[model samples]
Target: MTETELLLSLIDDKLRKCEDGYMLTHTHFLSLGERSSAMAHLKNRYPNHVFWGGYPDAERSVLFLLPEYMEKDDFSLEDEDDPLCLVRVRASSAKLTHRDYLGALLGLGLERSVIGDILVGEHGAEIIVMKSISDYLIANFEKAGSASLKITVDSIKNLEPPKIKTEFIRESVASLRLDNMLSAVFGVSRSDAVEAISRGMVFLNDTEATKPDARIAEGDKLVLRGRGKAYFREQSGTTRKGRLSVLFEKYI
Candidate 1:
């Protein structure tokens, strides 16, 4: 047998030994581009697995489970670790056209930008959804197999409304800045926020704030037409440049 087949078989064997009360339920996933046909394939093979779905924040590209996977009391973006098996399957890219293959793998609906990675463990399997797939899975594997397990997939809820902020920083405070005022306000990547600023997508109090490092005062109202809006508020504290820390709030 091929190495991957041997590994999957070994994992299946181990998973069959779960404690007397739970059933083994595997979570499988695929990118948006390959969802449709993939779901059809899975329906024929496993016919019993249920699925849940969700979208990640726009600026951050990926999809995760609804309600998320609880790992040690915290929700995780990736599935639990697996130790028994490993295999590499081809998947479409985030930018590719949406297709059926992805739905088949994840057993759920997904956005066009989602990516998938599959990892098999000693007693279970994990399907990861993210921009980049994990290269190693040796350290994160958890227990496998649930005997007589009852499964439930939940729904995803929108947590925060999306918004963007634009503002000007004083010269001194600008020196310590790793990013522009707009990004700080919106909590987005500096590069992305800057692009928006350059495109005249941002405004400071009704005026376009194109420069990533425009200097300004405490009460200025910044507006990013496409990204939402904010206002700056300077607080008490000096940085190495003898500049007080600048704070801003998106109008929400």
Candidate 2:
């Protein structure tokens, strides 16, 4: 079965248990894409039940699917030392990048969803992982991109998010279609942008975006696979040529 199907079954079972006055949990962590799907599924199927989802310190989170009587604060995901663990990795030469650390982690046969946000900073990074494989990763995840680094198993209590790099961008597009937006902001050809989107190399707000002609609005986050992540800031005034004048931010 697909991952979404599995989550649907899990949610169905959990919803029944929640109605029976039991607060059940998922046995897996969720990636950004999976989290988006799961939330949409819950909003459609179990709209009334209360659900809380968050990673200990990372940006991407899990779903709690709480019952009506349970408050979000009453749940102590961290105080109970939740199923998440933080792995602090620092290379001495400062040559490590976000992909390097992630590549190393994945090389150890870890699924992407079991891992949360990977905060990359200068000289090092902190990886939020499911506790089930924390030891396996710490012992085996010792090198990244040809450099050996130190890995520490840590709690999620004191993780500071990485300082993301952003650049303001202004461009004019013929339309609000995703390909046009991507081409305008990144200076790619419209055909190339369409090809990228068709190849499943694009994500709109963390979910896989397959429609190249989908409209891109202000506040939308566009992630170009292997390229970069961009956020639509606003629609500025139109240009004299009748093109749409748009402003956005690209995370570098």
Candidate 3:
């Protein structure tokens, strides 16, 4: 089955268990595709049920499948129970890159899903990991590359998200096709944009995109897997050359 189909089937099964007043959770952290697919399934199959998500102030989140009767108000969720943990990884007197942090974790046989966000800083980095694996990591994760590192358990509530650098971009495109907008925004040829989309290098709102001809609109977010992020704000007036002038925020 397709990934989306599999997620929909899983949600249906969970909703069945929810009818028995049991709250069910899937261990796998949902990616954008799975989350969106599951949510869409829930909306259609169980409209009044609760579909709550939490990563405790994290950029990405995991879902909690709840029934119609299981709603809440103002309760603070501790990161300790967030199914996640923070690892303060430090290399003495050395500033580690994002790669170094991820490399260390994966090298220790951790799956990508077990590792959440990796926030790099000046002296070290903080990474969010599955709580089930946190204790093991704290006890064993020692080095990143050839650098001797220290790993300590912390809480996600104490994490500070790194500020993303962004720049304003104003360009004119002949059309609102995704390829056209992406080409203008990233300074690539239209053919290059098409190629990128075909090769699964672009994402529309965090889901992998393959439609080069999809129409783009203002307020949409675009991400080139390894390139950067761009937010389409709105269109200004038409340019003297008869092209539509667009405004965007390009995150570096």
Candidate 4:
């Protein structure tokens, strides 16, 4: 079966389990594209479902299928009933990158689906993971790349993601077209921006956007696959050249 078909089948199974068993059921961590597809497939058919990671604004999340008796509000990362855990990894005298931590985890024979977001900090990293594997990781995980790691398991409620850093950009765009704004904020050629959109590499507010000329409003979030994410904070005013003066916050 195709990958998407497999994912849908798994989702269907979870839904059935929730309905038949009258309990909570969840899928593994899903990427942004997979989550979009899953939501489209579910639509409004299921009202008690929610997509969540350990924290807010998480890029990867799990889709939970709730039974009729359960309210969506009943579930929270802070609750001990959740299926997620926080794995804290502290390095000894060495800073570790996201890739280094991921490589080390995968080297331990764990599937990537079981892992959620990896928040790399100055001296260590905090990883969201399935509770089932938390004990195993704490027992087995030791080093990331060349740095020795001290691993500990904690409640998801204790997960403290690194503070986001952003680079403020104030530029004037000839138009509010996505391509024009992408070029201005990301510092790419107009042609490159258009190409990225056409190639399905650009997402507007977490959904894939293909139209280069699509209107981009203030407060829209733009994510370029290879590049970082940016937010259109606001349109200050028109520049002396009649272009739109826009402010953007690019995550650094």
Q: Which candidate has the top score in lDDT? A: 4
- Candidate 4: TM-score? 0.90
Question: What TM-score would each prediction reach against the true structure?
Answer: 0.29, 0.79, 0.82, 0.90
Per-residue alpha-carbon lDDT of model 4 for 71-140, expressed as tens digits?
8887654456788989888898456788899999999999999999999877888899999998899788
Q: Residue 201: error of model 1 in Å?
A: 0.3
Clash count, one per candidate: 31, 0, 0, 0
Candidate 3 lDDT: 0.72
Which pairs, if any, clash in model 3?
Answer: none
Model 3 residue 77 CA deviation in Å: 2.5
Residue 195: error of model 3 in Å?
2.7
For model 2, residues 1-252, the per-residue Cα lDDT tens digits are: 996798778877877877786654554666555665766777667655322223432346756666666565676565354777778887876878878877878888888768877777777888777788877876788789888888888877666655667999998888899998988877789999999888767778766777888998889988776677889999978999999899989987
The positional error of residue 98 in candidate 3, measured at the CA in angstroms, is 2.1
Candidate 1, after superposition: displacement of residue 34 in Å?
A: 42
Error of 3 at 7 (Å): 5.3
lDDT of 2 at 95: 73
Better of 2 and 4 by TM-score: 4
lDDT for 86 (candidate 2): 78
